[model samples]
Target: MLTCAVPTTLGPVIGAEQGHVRAFKGVPFAMARRFAKATPPLAWTEPRRCTDYGPYAPQPGQLDQPEDSCLSLNIWTPVGADGPLPVLFFIHGGAFVTGGGADYDGTFLAAHGPAVIVTINYRLGPLGFLQLHRHGLSEADNLAISDALAALDWVHANIANFGGDPDQVTLSGQSAGASMVIALATLPQARGKFTRALALSAPGRNIMSADHADHIARRVLAELEIEQDPSAIASVPLPNLFAAVERVGRRIADETEAGTVFGPVLDGSVIPREPRDVFADGTLRDVELWLGSCRDEMVMFLKSTPPAAMIRTSERNLRVAFGDAGWERLLACYRGSVRPDENPYEALLSDAFWHRPMADLARSHAEAGGAVWLSRFDHRPALEPFLSQGPTHGADNACLWAHLPDFIDRPILKRKGGPMMPADIDVAARFQTSLLRFVTSGMPDVAEAWPRFEPHRESLAIFGQPFQVVPLNEGARSRLWAELSA
Candidate 1:
């Protein structure tokens, strides 16, 4: 592998080059003590080797025994470019708990689009999202979001040396990361940081109210037996802290039927207001937006659920989300619309959690005069793991990255192992090309065929074998939500 060095704001860093793409891994953007706000890493006069990934945030069941100094980012840039290229800043999604930037290899996308690609690692689980301001630890709340802001600030100040254009950055993320993208786009601090945003499979209701966050924090403190001395939480052992987080998280999921217990909180300081309201109120009117979700988003969560338990939980959650009168009507609509092999409850939850919210956000952005594009990933790879179910959560990653080996080799998307079919390559090429166009330009189409998602038309591009554009479906489920909200 060829070696090179780029001078960043801190100092010079060594990276590895392979063919047309150069990769810089594990470059620390910021550092922080346990549960404290992150600060810039100490400057190094020597050429630091950034050829390998850095440590990830401490969380339950992580392999690397995560460290507090996990605020690092990886960069992939093309070898030969005439001028500065657009930047695609991505955040990985493991429900805001178990993922790091190392999981995503942006070399392919960087080489294909010839655009700079960046992925970051941030604090996670209780260490990242736990609310501690009420307990006198004001700086500890929303540490993960602060970590992200620091990373972005680093890129804006330093990406030009890596052949990336600082003015044309596209902020993008998936799942929990997608929610962070939404939060960052609406944040006053994140203004002028990026020109465009792309969010995939962002949960509709992931942001916790202040009361809900305080309640969860109290539960965590009590679990650790530190309710009396909340400051002692900083000294708790890693194992004990993670154990408390898991127990409290599971109990909350059981009670709320929500998949995650940790997420961005409306702390009135970091995230001042609801993100949905920000979208509707035209706060992001100047930023371009692209949003997407898989067809069967909830199947990944419900696949392991027992039939009786799944039914009971889904019904109860639906009742709570849509109230009694709207729940029955929504259930009937899903039963009539879902496929024979599909579960109605899963479909309803998928819409409630991912699809509906994405569509609504896109519509609101468009209505607010922001340019928007909407899409749904419908191409199900001809793999054994996905044979029974349609395109489930995280299925789009395999195609988007154009690397099927990662998906087949690992248990991601429930794949034990499988051969890469011809369709996989074809779909991956199409997906990557469209995304490349979007990254380079504001538009997401190779040709002028794909239409913008206007409020009246609400055109949605379906990413299937023969990529096509169609109107967004506002069926009985959407109507029910609209009526209930009204």
Candidate 2:
């Protein structure tokens, strides 16, 4: 066991050692109440023990109770490593309503690579994302995003003491977290803070306008039977608030076909414009980007939901994402790629909601003369017998973190969670190397040395058995997807 006095702008913090990795868990990056901007934590003269995980933000289906003080982060660094190593600043995804930094373990990445990994917890659901603008609390709107910015600012100020090169920071996230990454990349306040970014399975279209946010907020208030009084809403119990948020979220999903209920809104102040608009305006040209989605991203989420609802959701997503004509064109492009007996809605929804947007983002980056790499995670886990979800949404996360768990029960599938095959282990190692290379340098160092994503080529590095690079829209029906997007 080792300890270090890691100096911060606020003061020095004491972190414990775990083998070759020095871990600092549940380090408060900022302090904030619900619906308020996060501020720097008070300076401490005494050493603060950062050994245990912090309280998670209030979220739906959270196993543990939630807390208001959720703006914390965890750090993992090579114990004896020298200073100025690259840093991976990760954000967890739960559709903007759940998850925290504690869900991920950064030990493998920190120990194996010349990098320090930092995972952060931002506020979620109503507290973090509910647009307070129309309620006369505009300053508190997008508090979750504000929390993220505070965390990044803390890292920029204090990471050097943890042997990290703040100058080489790589901001990364999956799903709603990925959406946050994209949002940060577009925000003027976040410019020049991070060198590069990686967005995995980001649904870039979920950002709402102030009007849309107001509509949703009013609906949430009505569903909870609360007056438009912000104070009254704030005083409601978290469980009650989460229930309303979930109900409102489902209603919105059914009504508008949006990906989430609450997310970063174009609040005119914090987030001025849609992320895609920012990309189009060449605002994100400065940040190198790597982004992609899984093959069956939407299927994992839809599996448990009623099949009829899933089908309706898919159809609604197509219409909302591309309009009637565009949706028809897109459906034609994806129809042939799906298997004969399989429901084509999954493929259609995946292409329209996930892959197509990713491809468009890549194209936008390339058009802006920015450096970009596109990839598709197609590695199927051995959990098929139990989970049966195919390379589903966020599956790449397990491989990236090397925390694939053993399914203890059921004799044959026991101990068959991660690296079940030789290829699984190889993919994980290569994926880690690619991430390390991107953070350290500007490019990913895959076995084949991945190429820049351009409109004409549309080359994508596929992470799976016999990992290789291929055209993103290579298959028969998918060939026309690029045309439809154009």
Candidate 3:
């Protein structure tokens, strides 16, 4: 095995979880909970162990409790900054509920062509979303967005020392993380933080609206038994404050909270307003964007929702979520074509929340005069149809970073008895090549002379059984989009 030498910046970071080495973890970039004026962290010294992954930021309750000083970053650099290298900044997805940088390893990303890969840890759920109210402690409702901005700022200043070019930064993420990247493009604080952004499986308003956002902060404050004032709420103890978040999670899905106990707050501080509106109005940074979604993006969520509840979900709600024109268009495309369903609420949720938002976010960025690159991860899975979901979440993991077995264990996935087939390994190489090309030259489809996306005219790189450049499926896209945005 190739042993990893310690870097000057990081003494050495090690993990024995099978073929894992030459990778570093848990380096603090910013002060813990620094975004909020209220919360603080446990202290640490230079060269913090970082051998093991850090604890995740707070969640509402049970299952587990992350340590207080969990705000940190993990990095993988293939080589030194001998020359200017492309940069990929990663954000994790959790619906503001679960997930952390610890869940992913950047070795694949670092080895994918030439670039520096960075994954960050941010506050989640109540620790991130609950607002500061009129009465008591641990206020500052807009913690999630604030945490993201601070992490990016840390990268912009420090990535160069690790062989990454601050100017050529590419923001990459999936699910809620993808939504956060799209949101970052529009925030004044994150302005110039990255030159390019890629979103996979984003749900719109993962960015959010002012009133709905404000309510989150107010609710957090109310939990502390304080109302009307945010300052006092900010003073509460961090542990006490996090406990309330756990309490809310028990009945979030059915409650007024919509099962989302924590997320970006439209508190007018970290995040100014709805990201869709900002992009639509051209207030965003005007950077290049690459966005796409899988065809069966929601099977994961569907399998998890109670089967009995399936009977109760209102398709009309789906229509309202998407809108009339969108519904008709979707009905035309989805109905006649594939995935015909007795009822498609689960599919609707996927498109309405994840797929359409990413597409529109790309188009809006493109409409603002910035370049755009789009795609449909139509690749079929060797696994069961439901598991892979064409371009499901983590679908791109192998593609963008191939040779999983090369530097670490489990990079090359295997079944109990079947040999690991490189079925999509070649596709992953193509994806890595295209992504490398995009990061290096800002064009994932340089060969297509792939045109930029416009509100009136859209183009996409379809990645599936037979990869090809085709006009985006507008008929299917628009209707699904309209329904969700409605």
Which candidate ranks first by TM-score, i.e. highest?
Answer: 1
Clash count, predicted structure 3: 30
After superposition, which runs of candidate 3 have C-alpha atoms over 4 Å from their true positions? 1-22, 33-51, 60-66, 133-136, 214-259, 307-317, 321-333, 339-346, 383-390, 397-402, 405-420, 447-449, 474-486
lDDT of 3 at 151: 73
Reference-based lDDT, each prediction:
0.81, 0.78, 0.61
How far off is model 1, as Cα RMSD? 2.7
Order by TM-score, highest first: 1, 2, 3
Error of 3 at 59 (Å): 3.8
Residue 392 lDDT in candidate 2: 80
**TM-score, structure 3 vs. true:** 0.78
Task: Put down candidate 2 lDDT per residue, 313-385, tens digits, no spaces.
Answer: 6677657656899877766655655675444767777776788789888998889878899998888756553
Q: Which pairs clash inside model 2?
A: none
- In model 2, what lDDT does residue 328 have? 76
- What's the TM-score of each model vs. the native? 0.93, 0.91, 0.78
lDDT of 3 by residue, 339-373 (tens): 54323555555666566566777777777777777
Q: State the weakest 10-residue window (summed lDDT) of model 2.
A: 406-415
Stretches > 4 Å off in candidate 2:
63-66, 204-206, 257-259, 307-314, 320-335, 340-343, 384-387, 403-419, 446-448, 482-486
Q: Write the per-residue lDDT of candidate 1 for residues 393-456, one digit (tens) a residue.
A: 8777757764543343332222354556777777778878878888889888843688899977
